[model samples]
Target: MLELIAIFAAAASGDVDQVKSVQQRDEDIVVTGQRTEGSDDYGVSEQRTATRLPLSQKETPQSVSVVTRAQIQDFQLNSVNEVLATVPGVSVLAAETDRFYYSARGFEITTFQIDGIGQPFAFGIQTGSLDTSFFDRIEVVRGAPGLLSFTGNPSAVVNYVRKRPYREFHTTASAQYGSFNNLRLDSDVSVPLTADGSVRARAVGSVLDTDSHLDRYHLTRWTGYGIVEADLGPNTIVSAGYGHQDHDTDNAQWGAVPLLYGDGTRFDFARNSNTGQPWSGWGVIDRQIFGDLTHQFGNGWSAKVSVLRRAIDEDNELFYVYGNPSRTAPEGINAATGEGVFSYPGKFVGPTRNLTIDAYVNGKVSLGGRSHDVMFGIQRGAERYRQDAAYDFGQIGVAIPLSQLFAGTFPRPPFRRSTACTSSTAPRGGCPCTV
Candidate 1:
């Protein structure tokens, strides 16, 4: 009888221990339902990319597509190109190994935003592969978004929402490897700096090195981003951040390979073959600094001001080869001797800088038992860039055998550029009020 009583007592103690563990687990989880950075959920409960006002997917009038952090991780969309390819009605164009462009609804996308502030692009092309490590989510607003965005492009507006520093400490790391010798590593860390969790900082970095299926093509890129947020009062907050990225590509083709030989007959080439010299390459460097200030009033009203400055530098060394190839002599190439020639080697450098500032206030008002939302916003931007100077490389390159070209055995001579250079500056500003 005494032994049976002892067993019951022990069972009661075990139940108490389990209950304590559950309580501790619940306390450790921080769920505010306001932020989606670390949610690991495929869809967001609220979105504000279309308009500064908070609204759900169903409430927003425009067609919106949100690519959350969970989707980015699950689908391995490490670069901006890969992420956009998954969005509906969007098309990605690879102009070359380093340059890319995107289009939606049969029109080129010219407006891109970061945290609901942006500048219109004069040329609708993106240089280098933009890493996706720093973004919490990407929002695509199809059709015209001129209600908020300054530019009235009929295509689409892409907004990249940055990940904010969490109130609690958290860290995550991941690595990926795939075909063609591709390897990627990503790391994100968030830390609270104040005892009351009023100050926080976050850092994100990524590195990627890979070789393409195309012959002699290779790419290496790395990115680093850091941000800090501090709460000044109960309803006010300020934040600042900086980011840097470097992308370098080697053996990038300037143009497509010859489709037909000099003869009328077809000249089929291997799928992996490319008409590029081994010495051709392009490199780009990007740096950005930004800050934000936000405040909330008691009457469901909020105001925010954001500013960003971005700079981009590019260096290009391109080799273009064009000619028809045929086994028969005189018509195209003589496979026996290996002799053909069509090559242009050139080098150029260009630099661009931009500064943008945006401020907005939005709130809700009730009248006659009905609530209405209104917003007023202003945006100012300036861009300065040097024009591309075409360098003079005397004479065409000497003829090299087709076999030698395919074997990566080609000579690269030095290029001389012009002494004169020109630059241009563009300024833009707008004020848009919506209700």
Candidate 2:
């Protein structure tokens, strides 16, 4: 060992020289070159740079936009509709304070998804708005995402990504106030459960309340989301999570009628209707439950399954005066004893139910040194609708005496009393009149 060490030192020092002779061949030889501190090694940075996915840009196969939590916070966006309004090619028809008609790319988006699974539909006169507090990101894919989503409008698909737990302990909170007396508070906390940080958990919650610009309208919302993740092994991870949101609105108005003068000119309804009492008001309540499980195989493959249940209830009453100027009598002398006409009040109520089930598998595979990402899924959904309405006669009371009839007093008459009295074929109770 001593001789071997001495020979290696001599060779390294360049003190020995090589020769063609057998005797010289036994001597060690040294080669001269500059020594580098480290070898050229493949690293995370190198791999990332060498095989980076292209940033999404115009001309991509699909039109996609990403709304980050930071952007939502910056804009103080509270609902999905608010966020979507900022995107191009998206519009919302606010039928009422809580009810909305959402369309993108020239088509209505009736279906919604969270974490890429079908969420229930809030049908009928009710409203459905996605809360921004529970989501980490929102991805909008324009054009048919049929390959990844099912039973959705071909114009677009919205995927909401929930916040997940991390191995480190962290907490964040925020509060905001805005126009129309809007206020909101939100908080999130995440921590590891085990010393190795293999298991992690996180919780997030928020509350918001506000009065709308419309008369006698207000909104309140609350949401809670939690996630649990476990590192099964070096190459595998499993996660499960749940989220819930409850929303309520009171004194919501559908919309003001378009006002027109007798001359066929448009008038500002806001100014005119300001004097009239609210003809309609409503209360809406909606709740959502969501759960998901995901597992990753050792290979470049993984699977996720998610389920969501949403229920909605809404109560609405519309009060309107039923009358026709053309049916009025002469100024005085009881054109039947001419007086002003009376107006009957009418009200309508609507309710609905919706359910959806979605299941899918997503995975990636390597072939011929290339990676392919693929997703295939199936979905089934259904909705039920119901409605009822009632009408009532106001101050008019019983038939007015002809002696009391005067010029501007307006006439008060039952909708079908005369018709019912005249026709034997009329339905029982009264003539079936619709408002």
Candidate 3:
């Protein structure tokens, strides 16, 4: 477990209703404006992911949990999976070094959204790899949200609310250094870019380099993001942003070692006893460009249009060992017993591109002296996947003997260049962790 503590300072400000409340008497000016909601409460939140309506925690009719920006800073949660694990009734299954599956309500969750808009895109365990620095809050709604997300499954939905540009100028930076050659830095700055302060811009960056306790396990990662906003008029707002993240790992394990021998004799191995080939690892590079437009109508209704284009490029390789020992050869695995299997090398080199568009509107109507908020929207998403290599089944990789399992002295398998990984086959049990 990695433990870290940080000290941070924040400035708080609130925007009141547009109605000007001012009084001048005896050469003295007095102004009064009510705060947006109630007093500051960490336990309460104005959630929109549940119904696309601005409803307080007490008003929403669903089981929801909100991880606020303050909580993220206090707990030092930097990734999507770390934040989700802290939520109520959420569980994660880590099948591989890079694969993580989320489950809620006894079913694997496949529905997720950004700013309350969701697409038909199937989420992979790699969703955990997303950076959280660009978001203001994370909202999780338990149970099926077919009405809002249009997913008929009983799994839950997670929404990431992006941070908007601020007119005021503020900047914060933090750095940390720890064991195993670990070094990290995070910084963000928000500033006004116009004379009238109608346009704003914000930028955030992070860098990390760390070595794990496990032998030969090390990682290096970096992320950069920036956003700009313009207030075209009193009721129209537009914004654009770009985000990119890159990471690489060393000595990544394809699969765990065998637990017991073919004769039911268990093997006592050290924690770092890995079957990972020297050339096996994950090198991920992903980037996105997104923009959104919002217009507030004169009739108290609002509409929004959002578009995002994302691309994922990964080069990963793996080595797995598990099968029965061959009767004649001490190092060979028998096809029938399936115990002392030889090491096999495989690679995945598929890159995927995704374009998603979502639009929606929110308004209120009165009936029978009761007020109700209504919302409607449409979404379209397209994904393209390309493969550059292929895996051949008949040709097996290099094999090691069962006696050399713990000493790490066995001949490692040759690294196979990646072809098409989970990127394209994810729809067909390739990313079984996805669902």
Best by TM-score: 1
The sequence of per-residue lDDT tens digits that candidate 3 reaches over residues 1-435 is 111111111111222221111111222322211121123434544777888777887888988998877777777778787899899999977766656788899988878787666744444455226667877778899988887776646878998887776677878898878888888899999899997658999999988788766667667788998999888886788889998998788676665666666776665667766655556677888888899998877444788899988888877655556554554445645555654556555665667788889899988888999988888889887777654543445445444566664344434334344334344455532432211
Q: Write candidate 1's Cα lDDT for 126-225 as tens digits.
A: 8789899989889998988777777758889999888889888999999999999999999999999997778999999999999988898899999999
TM-score of each: 0.84, 0.65, 0.82
Candidate 3 wrongly placed segments (more than 4 Å): 1-44, 119-123, 324-339, 388-397, 402-435
Indicate whether candidate 2 or candidate 3 has the larger lDDT.
3
Clashes of 1: 0
The candidate with the higher lDDT, 1 or 3, is 1
In candidate 3, position 338 carries an lDDT of 55
lDDT of 2 at 144: 72
Q: Candidate 1 regions off by >4 Å?
A: 1-34, 263-266, 323-341, 388-392, 395-401, 419-435
**Most lDDT-accurate candidate:** 1
Give Cα distance to truth, residue 57, candidate 1, Å: 1.7
